[model samples]
Target: MDSSGAGAGAASPNPKCCVSLSAFYNNTIVPCPNCSCNCKGLPGAKCHSEENAGSMLQMPHDPLQEPEDLVRCTDHMCPIRVHWHVKQNYKAYWRVKITVTNLNMVRNYSDWSLVVQHPNLQSVQQIFSFNFQPLKIHGFLNDTGMFWGVRYYNEILMQSGVDGNVQTEMLLSKNTSLFTLHEGWAFPRKISFNGDHCVMPPPDDYPRVPNSSTASKLSLPVLVFISLLPIIIFVGPSHFLDYL
Candidate 1:
């Protein structure tokens, strides 16, 4: 009876058919473990996971490199104004406030960055956003210069249509001996955004440092007293008393 049952031909599972239980549960087809094709799933499909889903759409980017022809300032009549002020002045160091204003009446700017070159810029001690609140900024400064690539957190996006204008401010400390301050304001050697120089008005409008020595000069009374001393010595005491 056993021999007759064997001859009846009950089907056996195929050796080529191999599918994981997880794959079956997830409704995905995984390649057989022994297969040479190494096909994990459908060509365009993937097994979804929380970690993988978060990274699937990521693209590589270099923060230092800017996109080509991102700014067309030459073609547009819009202008970017750069103004700087000396907030504090000392013998060795000074604090400066830099203002960048987008004077573009019609266009909007996004992903903007600024580069300022100064011989005496030592470091950036603090930064402020458009709201006049302290903001964490990313940049570096050395003896030669300083640069900042403004991103979403601190980027200046001037929506000319809505706000009418946009501006950003930065406060920095510099080595005073490296730069010359006329009046109380000092100008940077160059100010640029995305490799294009911004338009700067004449320094005549900036604040000036008062000449401290001018006030220390001899007054008319003091000068007269000094002159009288020499004359008093040349003349006799009786003559000086007579003149008095």
Candidate 2:
């Protein structure tokens, strides 16, 4: 959770592979003087000229896969905890609950915001809160193949918490009809509160009531096994002997 590696003006370790947000948003393409493929348009355009191929920037790598960029803060002294929950998950839609708690004994946060990032999020359908009005919400894609959603709210009182419930819908990328959700789907890979990354404690650290569906699925198998156990014990040996 060393955040020194992440900052607004942080330098890119690999300049050739990384594009600045300013350059990308302005559609400024720095083409290799010797290459033929223009870097001025969409991402991943190839350089047809063999001479310039080596100099052209290769396709941008997935930022999530990079360890140094995906670092999570382990520091717990910040007195705030951000909890993310996937309330409902579907093939193309999902709902999320993000709870921000001020764990400080005597301090209150006048204004705060949560920042979350994903790769395939389409849009945030709704943001609900019981006590506060939504101040601002922004969603945008950058050159790093990551989409970011930032939400702002005002007034979280001392020793209290607030919940931002968001419903979002997603769509597949072009030429792809399906994607797997087993790997961190509909979950924020990175979370920050008021510009500081918060500790993401493990799920086991929190107590949760069992879901009804899960309980029913488990109970049905146990009930069937219990009902058949006596029959198996009383009838198995006799039936085997008769068959023999």
Candidate 3:
């Protein structure tokens, strides 16, 4: 998807949107603009512990499963690598940089998006949204910080029309709650979240066809038999009548 077309004004490049290691810690944050919204905080971000790190919890997912996990610090379901960066102390507000890469090629990408939930805030900021410009790939694709300074926290959805290739990144900030971030969609099909990655489970006990569609649609044998039927009956009679 070329960004040079009619709707090209949607994306802008920035210095902060490039890949940079965090000055605070071992963390690294990529820059990407965010969309703003005032959605409520997630319920479970208030209480977190190392003991509850690997615990399983129910979470919503997009129709298609993502190849990488959403959270990196835990072993829940989606297993994509997650990095954290802070522009300043958490007193006023903090900025978060998140990176998500596609590792699966089974599904075509259309409505890819991310949602971050914070449970410890009285109010939240708006969420700015952007996506990697589209390109073709034999298998996978990646987007690493194509937009920056997004300023919002509610459901942030990426722009459509992307070519699946390998490695992608998106940046977000917490305008409302304490800590909870998600990346997935609900469009193509129902997906299941296992913590490390989103999984598209096979249909629930859907029945299979009795025969292969390729073999079942053949009519060659019937036509051949009909073509030879008259030849065998006619040629054997008139020509051999004198001999019989």
Candidate 4:
């Protein structure tokens, strides 16, 4: 074990460098604010692109020494990012998909797990691919959940590359009092990976369910009524019904 905690519970020194992104099932996207880590323009910063992953794997690793951060090249420059997507709405439930991406080209994460806090998690119907356990937050139903990859599968989050990600989908029953997809209600209230505090985008920047969608739903009854009127009024007229 590294006395400095290199591979043990390692977290981002600068939270600003680990911004996460989120999207809606419709693919509406949002990004974090402009805050960034000091590594960008400093004299001695190190980074690796997807192409150099082979060489990075060959470098010496010393647990006793402080390890270098060989993060992948990205526009946000985050070493890891968790993407949450609200996938669909059903009559009694909604679906979401979460993806954990590794942007650090130098290291892989072992025995990684995710902790998520959301009100609907208390009523989770099913979770796919990942193993799940509910964690209590207030001595009540565990709205906070611990998720990890299935054994001999994705438990080891790979280094950045074509195979550097793990993903899972969840179905949660709607809470009559709290469930609402509008105003970013679908986004998790809190999220963490490997015990590291993650940076989240501003709530204002979260994806919103457009007002028009609500309006369209409201008008559906009228549309159905209108469509049925001609059939009711003309059912008795065989000549007019023949055109239908």
Question: Each candidate: what lDDT?
Answer: 0.40, 0.36, 0.28, 0.72
**Local accuracy of candidate 1 as per-residue lDDT tens digits, 72-178:** 12212223444455455556555555554443332234545455655444555555553322222225444334344245553444522244233444455555555
How far residue 192's Cα lies from its native spot in candidate 4, in Å, is 1.0
Quick one: best lDDT, which candidate?
A: 4
Q: What are the runs in model 3 whose C-alpha is more than 4 Å off? A: 1-23, 27-84, 130-244
Task: Output the lDDT of residue 83, model 3.
Answer: 26
Pairs that clash in candidate 4: none
Candidate 2: tens digits of C-alpha lDDT, residues 117-223 = 54443454445552222222453452112212333433332332233222222322321355433434434445454455433334332323334464476677788
The TM-score leader among the candidates is 4
* Superior by lDDT: candidate 1 or candidate 4: 4
| Model 3: ten consecutive residues of lowest lDDT | 31-40
Ranking by TM-score: 4, 1, 2, 3
The model with the greater lDDT, 2 or 4, is 4
Backbone clashes, candidate 3: 55
Q: After superposition, how far is residue 68 of candidate 3 from its true place, in Å?
A: 15
Q: What is the Cα-based TM-score of model 4?
A: 0.75
Give one clash count per candidate, in the order shown: 4, 1, 55, 0
